[model samples]
Target chain A: MTATQPKPRTSRPGLLGIYRSDLGKKYAMAISGVFLLLFVFAHMVGNLHAFEGPEQINHYGEALRELGEPLLPRTMLLWVGLRIPLAIALAVHVHAAYALTLTNLRARSGSYDGRNYLAAGYASRTMRWTGVITLLFLAWHLADFTWGIKTVNPDYVRGDVYGNLIASLERWPVFALYLMAMGALGLHVWHGAWSLFQSLGINNPRFNAYRRIFAIVFATIVTGGFVTVPIAVQLGIIG
Target chain B: MNLTLRVWRQAGADAPGRFETYPAEGIPPEASFLEMLDIVNERLERNGAEPIAFDHDCREGICGSCGVMIDGVPHGPQLGTATCQLHMRRFDEGDTVVVEPWRAAGFPVVRDLMVDRSAFDRIIEAGGYISVSTGSAPDANEIPVPKDAADAAMDAAACIGCGACVAACPNSAAQLFTAAKLVHLNLLPQGQAERDRRTVAMVDTMESFFGSCTNHGECETACPKGISIDTIALMNRDYLKARLSDRRLLGRS
Candidate 1:
């Protein structure tokens, strides 16, 4: 056979090019997902300090503002260094999720007439629905606790983290909504943790079992930990 | 065995397509899926109708040319079997199988049950090969590959460019096909020289036309060759490494 001339080398895609693709979006989602996971886990642990008493939990909330005090202005370091990055991660995660969903919708113009999802799990299938729920829940959570929005939390007070949590959870409807959101968070994190490793290219058959266990355990702990707070408050254990 | 086939038909790519039901009678249980289609087509031809235009070559299931959604499952319900290899015995008499083309924006239908998978070809053209100098065969012992690596590479190489992974995926992702190609080459000694370049180019090309892999595992199920999703993980690793390192090689200061 005659030797064919090699084609000219195509210019390498830049970082922007990488982000434009489906794989790049997945990487963005995974990396940002890790950041969000860290924040979620930390938030759950911080909230769990409420079990000790109002003083312990209140101090923990105050410590967040006092982070990096000598080197930086009050609350400046936490807001600038940590919160900003977390916000960026959340933005990227949501953006990528939306873009991927649109692309996926376009890719398959129509569903199968007689379809069966043999291999897909409940968590995998409900990712979009859970994601939307989590987003809405996040907004409500921030409004009620962080921003002290009176409409959502009539008794919300600034800097009084423990009191605010109890006042919000005192309402049965609020407690139920919080519990439902945590359930959605549990499902989201369960699938995200398991699949994030694959997105980051760490999958191996040998470690797959461990991945599954980690996802379930981590999701359960975070969700269960958060759920305990409202239940504790409602039961007057912490209130 | 007698069967009812709701086959999708389209006059052209721009034209609308719809499912047309037809009776497939007196088909032997031993006949392959394509053979059953052949009998149906013969009857349609005798009745002065336009015979179904489907894609098939190498009915032995090696070429990866034949594929259709049977009862909404790519390559039917048989695991790890191609459409051509699926026999009528898998379906019982009086079964109503809904046959449709691989429905994806990237894979447009050319006619009845045949899709234009040239997007896959474009991905291959992007970078699915090594830049080997044309010459006589090199000695087998020149560069010895580990037994496991060779086996793994061969396993990934088993992909026949079939679009079942795309069809089977809800997201219509081509990660399985692209990963198979990338792993088949990247695992080998010859392929190492351009591994980074190949990963970036091929993945970029794939993302242009396909959906993202959400770890749905449907691609592995739809794969006639039973290609593992592990290959996709390997490809992701390589692409990440390539994006970071390949920039330096491009003389970007």
Candidate 2:
């Protein structure tokens, strides 16, 4: 076993095997989560056009539709750039979460009448619940806005982004739903952003402080940015 | 001091265990938790009943033999102390304490309050040691290890393999335990030779019996040795590095 000439590496697990390993599943979750995080931030930023009034927000929406006109064709960039990659990242993230959750459930400790905790954070403890709520919200978001489903969005008007946002959010129930979903998103992202670093092997005592602050700040900004638009519409400021 | 005790009583590994109530009457508060249990066991035997079974040795706490979930917390509510080191004074006179075994898929109940922790031994056997030819012991300071590295390594080495971490973890993840072992060796110069191999082997072996870590930090909280969760960060990093560097070092994937 001395350190000498290396032997053939025949026993090592291959790429596929590694990917299937628990650590590999963690890597998948972390990497996919990074992409989703980027999308949410970019989304909040893009939606900020609402602050400028209807014309500006509508103009911003059109830009997305015609993002790669001529060079890549209309909506091509939107599909390849935003929609496709986001869907893939979301799928991978959910699959990894589901698989890891199944494993955790079976690796059981026999029941105790009382169980106490010391260090697990509130956000971390509720990750699965928050994640599920966020997923369901995503589905509703796609149906109401992107697909412009008539039943889901009774006032949905094609190509009228400002009108649609105002029409949907003017309803108190929908506004409440949006606020609740954003809250869940904040909890999910707060723990998730911090967790991704550990899963990606980016942990160090140096960055540890910034890691927590960054996750908290990011979660707040994203949630605030999103919840503001619906609130503005409901309060008759934007509408 | 008197207390009501609900002990998990199992006749065998596959036996159905239940909480059997016993009264710790007129016992000394200064008794260690295990000693209190011993007093109760003596009472049960004197009453012509079966004595409760639990593991213990070197009750000063260094042996890593004794552990139990007292009232749902691994190693009880006390911070950074094993069950053997936990004094009975920590509880109130009439407190109702529920005692249970360290439960996990990897740790099967052997009998009342005792679990088979050999899964940890298997993980160690996988690749926990550094390889060197047998000879006269080398000089203590031969390698000139950085003071900070040595300190961190010692902190990791303090883990006595008590399995309290797994018992406390919601996911039953062994990352904290695995990481403690990893940091103990991986930070040393002599450990550099097989650092990657050891990391890969040990982590993989752990995964087979345990759940993936979700960064809950419960393991660190329950660790009797006060082993930091940062050791888990080191294990994750080393495992990833092994996957990359081992390919290049061994030549051809």
Candidate 3:
């Protein structure tokens, strides 16, 4: 009846409702994927410090560890401030991904009919599994390396973080775990990075080939770079 | 030139589909893709095997009925051209061609290389048309449509509903098809009344049948008409507007 309104009201849900639908879940997953890729770049840069040898790497680690120290003022809490946002971003990213997978599965209603994988690559097809495997690897890495709570070999003490890493890599089982985990990371990065570009509407005919090349180059560098450290340690290339 | 063709063969809708290999002989490089298929089918008929049951109504490319996943690419390696318009010169002599029907859950295989695209029909039925009445045709100049708007409408109308978009999409999403129809119909002044209803009904119907669009540009790449994914964004915008607008004025409930 108001001038702003046109006709009689209906019972249908509003535009907000559309954003809460199944399609909305995908949009959330897409937005959060950007955050996850950012985290990967930061993590990779942190890992690269290992290449600078023990003194540089250990100092960097110690600096990161002191970021949230209680003696520091709120302005000085760089790591703590960043960690909170990163945690939220990671949560939304992982939750949205799982929700989307569940929605896809439910929409199909438990059917395992044949699917075409031609327009997709192996990494793109196995995103869900790769994501899960990477998550599990994260948990193991945090416990073994970050918390210093577990050890495959009791003789390996945790005095030096760098020495601990080398000793852990020397153990076949630990090295195998790291290799498998890095493989998942490689797959995750390959597809996730490409999909992020697509979601943001930046992926077009002109930039598609470049985006693909970047994804491959990034995946190879990160995965290959991380694996080298473990391999070098296992082969006694580093102390 | 001689070429090896692997065409999908199925006896009926319920029957299992399999690839049947055949040799394409004496094919002219200038002939259209469908003509090349016809040559292969002629050889199959002579051998007493059932000719591949692919769909084709207008070989001139207007009808949008003829399509096949050619050698792993929808509508062949050529971009922006339909399968029927694609020339044989694109392929090398003695090359192997793999042809299959449009792969989608909504588009079930009816026979060899023929999928029942009734799902698209159902989506159209859901709300593809305008409710405007016709008497004597109005003068074209009576409506003052801007040049840009008319051009965009034509662009969207260019979608042939060949399901190439669905096949090329990794998610097998039909958003491009649904959005094209919605945008094409809603752009004109006549389609204004039913715009809201059309967007909602068509999008809901599409979701029930086809896979979700993940915004990948693969469909845009495979579309014979080169329908832009921008239509999907338009659909989203209209659907959002429709939610607040009254249903009675919009017509259909």
Candidate 4:
């Protein structure tokens, strides 16, 4: 077989790779898992500045702006460039997850017998649904903040991003949505963090205790950081 | 203790199986679940009936031959014990324990509870071994594996080729079992020579037989040794790296 010739994608036995056959799906998950994990850490750091005063948080955002500084055509294009790939990654991860889930559900049509507790963790079991909700929240969050599309406050400005955030969170429904999205983010991180260690071949039975502990700690930090943003903004603390 | 049992019975591979109810009256509560089945078989034999053909060997739970769904849960309702290791004391008196074989298309039922797990052997044959020739054994400490790597490899090696993961997983994925083999062989220095080839062959074979993982935690939960789902992730990373990094395969004949 020459290098230029396209390699045939062999379909393994058992109906189009339901549950066990698809190799691409597994790596799609792993590679995307790495990217998503990086996004989580970056997002957490950006969110942590909220715990300081409003100026500190806005300064952090400004620092982010400095990375893609020379805004030639549009200032918001910098943010859009960063977000587009993240959105694409999110779309692939969630779409593959949903497709894999549907295939698995069909294959195991006769076998389910209430072995809910037999699964590895609560997070793994609910990964599909949680992924769907997280995607929806991501779209809404982008419109509300990134693109400055829809906000409760019509006076939302482009470069005045921090002020726009403060105004948006002051509304009861917007605050509630932020809280719910953060909770979903917490669930995603709780399992994904430890699983990343496993993917990178860091699993030791002895160190597994450490891995679980770190998972909880990381989950807590991300959850606390994101949740603090909305809560602080809603109150008179951040504005 | 007297208990009711609904067991799946099929005479041959082609025969369709169904649940048959049997009233089992046992005097000992400390007997293993398989021992309880043995007691029921003894009675069947005396009555000029063919014994219930369930798979078991080395009742110590190390052989991985004995596996069954009991009361809708694999290996009964125990947290981390296989059927051979599960005791009768866990069940209440007069309880109805439903028993069934490991049901998956890849594992066809050969007898009553004996499904052909040769698929696992086939997967192994596809490339589950180190290619070290039959030569003199190397020095024990020659291949100095790091403590962490050795520890992790041993943990992965803990898997006993049991179909419990396949049976328990909603997707019937052999990722845990296949991954265990991948991790154990890929982690050691001796196994490093065949590392790239090992991952591609084993994982490709597994993909040919089992379902893809959707991050369901059932396999880890059903595993008697508490093998984590992270093995699947490691296998994924290794396979991807191998696909890109295998230098020998780049310009070879």
Candidate 5:
């Protein structure tokens, strides 16, 4: 018997490699999570302009569409170019999250008879449920504000950003749904923001405290900023 | 101490298992957890009942062979202690204790309180070594390693390959075990030649069988050696760099 010489071949992992491994999927989730976090912060700040006045908020909405105008075109450039990266990030984030969840379920053949959580945190345990809630909220948010769907908000007008927002939040049911969604968002952001750093391999004992603080601060600000608009509208403050 | 034990009983790997209650009376306080189990098995044998089977070796903590999930926490709730090191004194008289094997898809039950952990061996086999030609031992002073690096390497090297980290994890993730193996060698200059290749291959192998790490930090607590979770972060960093810059594919071009 004899052994044959093997042919030389490259062992490099290509772009698809990120999706092939759990660690790579985690890195993808972390990077996309950071991108989504920045977008959420920016979006919350823009929405807070409603507290100033209807005209200010309306102008803010228009400005978003008109960004990079002279160099590019209206809304065309914004949707086609500027928002492409965000859309890609969101798609990758959702895909990776779903894949990880499935893998986790398959890994556990059976659960403990009487389970006790010693080191697991509340946010970590509830991430999947909170993530689902946030996804549903995102779809409804796009319908009520961006697409001006009458089913979500009867008063939603194509160009009336401020009026549409106030009208939607004025209703008790819509406000309640928004509140619940914000609660879920708060939990998701809190866990996601703190853990993403570790997922990206930035774990250090010295910065753990700061990481917790950052997660809390970021979640509070984003959730608070968005929730304030609806509550103020209900109180006639925005009107 | 007279305690009630709810032990998981199974016939074989493919067989279904369940908790069977047994009264462990007259157990000594000084007896280790495994010793108490030995007493229970002796009683069962005298009664013509099947004796419970569990894994243990070296009776001391160094072997890493003994493991059981006691009351849902791996290694019986004693911090940084293996089952062999957990004395029966820790449990109160008449307490009800649940004893179970490591529950993970990657670790199928071989019998009562024992599961196949060869998945870990397979992962190590994937890339957990440096390619060195066997020869005479090098001089002690040949390689001058910094004290801190040597210390860190030793710290990561303390992992005993116990599967408690997997059993205790909510997702059954093995990131800590894989990370410990990677960090122990990757920190040493002797492992520099195949650092990138080792990282990529090992990580890929791990992902094939285990769950993803969500940073729950449960694994660290469950580890008998008190292996730090910092090794996980180091592994992640090395893996990312390897994915981007390893010379595996470039050789083709």
Candidate 6:
């Protein structure tokens, strides 16, 4: 756009270049991953209202519905500003994961017949599987709670967040599914939290320990907070 | 040490490869891995059989020419040791040792345990160097590199161009190798002029045939020189600066 600008050193095709290159795809994945991580953490903290009894939990749900009442409108800010952005983030994360999987496969022209791993942790290796399971769990979760699908949760009430949570986890099979999903989410976060820093080029040997501790603690807290409500309901502590 | 070798036998790049077992009996424990292979090849030739094909030079660990997946671990189970430095004593009697080439799209099998690692040369050629006037070695006093930068650069410079990092990575990523090469030069004052161009060009060349890094730490474990993964973070920083800065990488400006 300027006369003094230097010549194009790369044929890097703009935004499309991000998707075409290996590093750019990771940047997309890591950036989107950050939003998803924040969403899950905030979701868990909000859900902790269930411990304060039905009144607090239901009020928390209504607060979300009326996020920008006077300034904007009921649910306007929540849907347009938060939920829609989260959905896009999730979509981008999934897209990047799918593309990278193919690249990794092709790069490995073929593996050694006796190939074995030395330092790749189980959580790092099982990211794709855990990621898929997390997606499936998200669908079930939305149906049972957000969409109020009768078949997914017969006792789901539109605004009764506490009642819906209790009714859903009361079923043994549903409880099992939630627990399994939490395990998968924990593993995904463990690898992803640290990986995001590397993908973003914000790393050094000096702060590696802090990065590790953050990944473990974040994974633990997020998984623990979300699962606490269901376990409390099952134990009759919330009733 | 008496070892049973399950060595991959391939005639050429396009030839059908298979495991060809051979007994390496009465081998001295002190003999290097390549030396043991030498003994095996000598016996095979005496019996009118084709010797195993492999790459080796400067039996010392510095050359980086010799390497293989010894029992599934690149450069064998001995950590921070090259295949040339790995000794037969690392094995036991009657052990079944598996030897295979670095199997990656970027590194095709030439024959037997030998792989064509020319992909690495191409990556380096893309940028891994600084432009110089090619007269003679400049006086060390002319350029005063800070102690920290010099040490870090030396650490990166220890890379031997071995493909073990690629062979060990589950994704076959050359990020570690490329990072080391980039860091070795990018950290110096001499590399400032073309730093951004070198980073972008080398990284693009690397991704052409290799996979992306996922921070598995496998490459560091399999690396003979024990190069740290922090170099990768540095390369990432350099690349982002080049592509995201206001300076447009536009054509012929």
**Best-fitting candidate, scored by TM-score:** 6
Could you estimate the TM-score for every candidate?
0.93, 0.95, 0.72, 0.77, 0.94, 0.95
lDDT of 2 by residue, B105-173 (tens): 888888998888888887888788878743456765666899999999999999999999999888888
Distance from true location, Cα of B5 in model 4, Å: 2.2
Q: Each prediction's Cα lDDT score?
A: 0.88, 0.87, 0.74, 0.74, 0.87, 0.89
**Which is better, 3 or 4, measured by TM-score?**
4
Tell me the spans in candidate 6 whose CA falls farther than 4 Å from its real position.
A1-13, B138-140, B246-253
Any residue pairs clashing in model 5, and if so which? none
lDDT of 6 by residue, B1-253 (tens): 8999999999988899999999999999999999999999999999999999999998899989999999899999899989999998888889999999987878888889898888788788889877775345666547889999999999999999888999999898999999999999999888887888888889988887688898898999999999988898888888877777524545645
Instruction: Identify the superior model by TM-score, candidate 1 or candidate 6.
Output: 6
Task: Name the better of 4 and 5 by lDDT.
Answer: 5
lDDT per residue for candidate 5 within A62-166, as digits (tens), equals 888898877877887678755898889989988999999998998888899897777888988999999999998989999999888888888888777889988
The TM-score that candidate 1 achieves is: 0.93
**Error of model 1, residue A48, in angstroms:** 1.3
Residue-level lDDT of model 5, residues B1-253, one tens digit each, is: 9999999999998888988999999999999999999999999999999999999999899888999999999998788999999999999999999999999887888899988888788778878887884345765347778998899999999998889999989898889999999999999888888899898878877766778899888899899999988899899999988988957667797
The DockQ-based CAPRI class assigned to model 1 is acceptable
Comparing 1 with 6 on DockQ, the higher-scoring candidate is: 1
Model 5 gets an lDDT of 0.87
Candidate 3 vs 5: which has more TM-score: 5
Point out the higher-scoring one by lDDT: 1 or 2: 1
How close is chain B to the truth by TM-score, in each candidate? 0.96, 0.96, 0.94, 0.95, 0.96, 0.96
Candidate 1: tens digits of C-alpha lDDT, residues A1-239: 00122233333467766787677788999999999999999999888999998889899999899998878888998899888999999999999999999988977767778886768888888999999999999999999999989899998889889999999999999999999999999999989998999998998778877998999999999999999999999899988
Q: After superposition, which runs of candidate 2 have C-alpha atoms over 4 Å from their true positions?
A: A1-15, B134-138, B247-253
Q: What are the chain A TM-scores for all the models, listed individually?
A: 0.93, 0.92, 0.80, 0.77, 0.92, 0.93
How many pairs of residues collide in model 4?
8
Q: How well is candidate 4 docked (DockQ)?
A: 0.18
DockQ of candidates 1 onward, in order?
Answer: 0.43, 0.42, 0.10, 0.18, 0.42, 0.42
